[model samples]
Target: MAQINLQNVNKSFGPGVPLAVNDLTLTIEDGEFLVLLGPSGCGKTTTLRMIAGLERQTTGDIRIGERVVNDLRPGDRDIAFVFQFYALYPHLSVRDNIAFPLKAQNLPTEEVNRRVMDVAERLRITHILKSNPGRLPGGEQQRVALGRAMVRQPQAFLMDEPLTNLDASLRADMRVELKHLQHTLGTTMVYVTHDQIEAMSMSHRIAVMDRGVLQQVDTPLNIYRHPQTLFVATFIGSPPMNIVHGRMVGARFVAGDGQFWVELPPAARQYTQHDKRVSFGIRAEDITVGAPGGAGMAGNVVVREPLGDETVYVVSVAGKTLTAKTPPRIRFNPGENVSVKLDPAAIHLFDGDSGRALLPEGWSKHV
Candidate 1:
């Protein structure tokens, strides 16, 4: 069992260049699955490489279990790195590809064969052991790569978007397989992916990053329901959270365009200033749209998109575009006026200039 820790880690391409990872500090418990999730060039992969000894940090300490391994080489790190592409030799058979790492270590021939067949059996690829890499399907090729990684019994696994090359259906299938594999092996895993669905489905906890900075770290449910920053609130959702520029006025939220207003309880005043500029945020699913002249904002539907699972409507409320998600069976044509009601408890308030969640201490109960 191995626990990985990174403390005040920083990396840069050159002396005068900007940092790739800035003051990153994180800890992964032994046998835990930690996912580094972010978009391209956000430094997630770089952080994984630093842990695997493939890249050096400008300043920090990387500890594997109880030992500092900053100067160690990749091979000596006791961690297996899985690439996005299948790195198998085209001429080698599946069994040979799985056994190559053991052979390189000069283990006994019988031992190498035993480990290879064992991993093949575990991966359910024993029937294709003799097939060449080029002859295998994409899913089977990935299994071969994983078999190779598993045969080593490394302290941890660092995967850099290993399912990126597969089709959508195959990628989803592999996600289930990979999660089960991690559970069975109980090895420390630092997985890198930009796909939120993959991260949400597989990780025990997610580390969200953006532009070389850590945004928030939490469970998938918490990340979805209670985003702490504007960036995270906007990035984590599919239709994205609707944020309207507004101000708090005597128990009322008035929009910047003077279109409509929302009644706020007097108790919420402590969370906002009098007529202070603020951002009002609510998820698409939390808003209900219907006929006008009710307890909500009156708006005209600009467009309706049917997504089978649900219908998304773009509504013009006081000249501001707000997206609302409705039931799949609900039908609305463009130019239809609708009343939009936001779940009172679901509303989010963010500071206008800093874009930070405005929550009173002990705010969990309210949320």
Candidate 2:
């Protein structure tokens, strides 16, 4: 197992140009499953490549478990990488492809055979050992690709969206299999995915990046519950968090339409020395829906979708529109009026002008 540490690591394409990874400092624990999540061109893949020595860092140092590997080549570093596309040798059989790394290391032929059989059997692709990539389905090819990586038994594994091309059913099945494999191997795994669902489900911790900046890093639940910035609050959750322009009315926070009020506790109300134009954030799940009581925020049910397991609602609340998820199969027809309530504990307040979280220095997290 390897614990990765990056100190002031930065990468750029040209001299004196904008950096692709800007002063990123992070510590990934040994045996931890960390997912790097962001949109395309957000520097996630750049960071992963740098770790594998595929790309050189313009500044700072990279350490893998006490050894500073800044000058080492990719082959010299003990890392196994699984790319988005299966990079298997088309002419080689699956067993040969999985045994390639062991051959490179000049290991005993019997040992190579043993490791290949073990991982292929575990991935449920043992039956395809004699087949080539051209004859294998996408899912089977992915397993072979992963088995090839697993054979080396490297200190760490780096996966760059290896399952992005699979079907939905295959994606679900593989996710469960991957999680189990990581646990069984007990290896340090760094995964990259643009899908938040994948990051949320597979990662022990998540690192969120945007515009070449590392925004936040924390446990999946902590990151969702305590987003450090407006960018993270908007990016990490499904259906996204609902944010609206509002003003602080003494102890209460009211929306721009002045129809709804957020009941802030005394501590939360006193969070700011004096900041106006606040941005209020609440997740779709935090909103409780009901028939318009004529007193709450003015809204009409614009759309309702029953997904068998739960109902997704699109409500035009106040001057802005927002989405909510609920389980009650209430027959509130479309265009019917409805009222919405924001849970006190679920409400997140930020500074509108600066777009920064506005709270006491350390007690940003409230009871």
TM-score for candidate 2, residues paired by index: 0.93
Misplaced by over 4 Å in model 2 are 15-17, 254-263, 273-275, 359-367
TM-score of 1: 0.94
Residue 9 C-alpha lDDT in model 1: 96
Each prediction's TM-score versus the true structure = 0.94, 0.93
Please name the candidate that would achieve the greatest lDDT relative to the true structure. 1
Model 2 residue 58 CA deviation (Å) reads: 0.9
* Per-residue C-alpha lDDT of model 2 across residues 125-234, encoded as one tens digit per residue: 88889987778999999998899889999989999999899999999999998988999898999999999989999999999998779988999998898887788899
Minimum summed lDDT over a 10-residue window in model 1 is located at 358-367
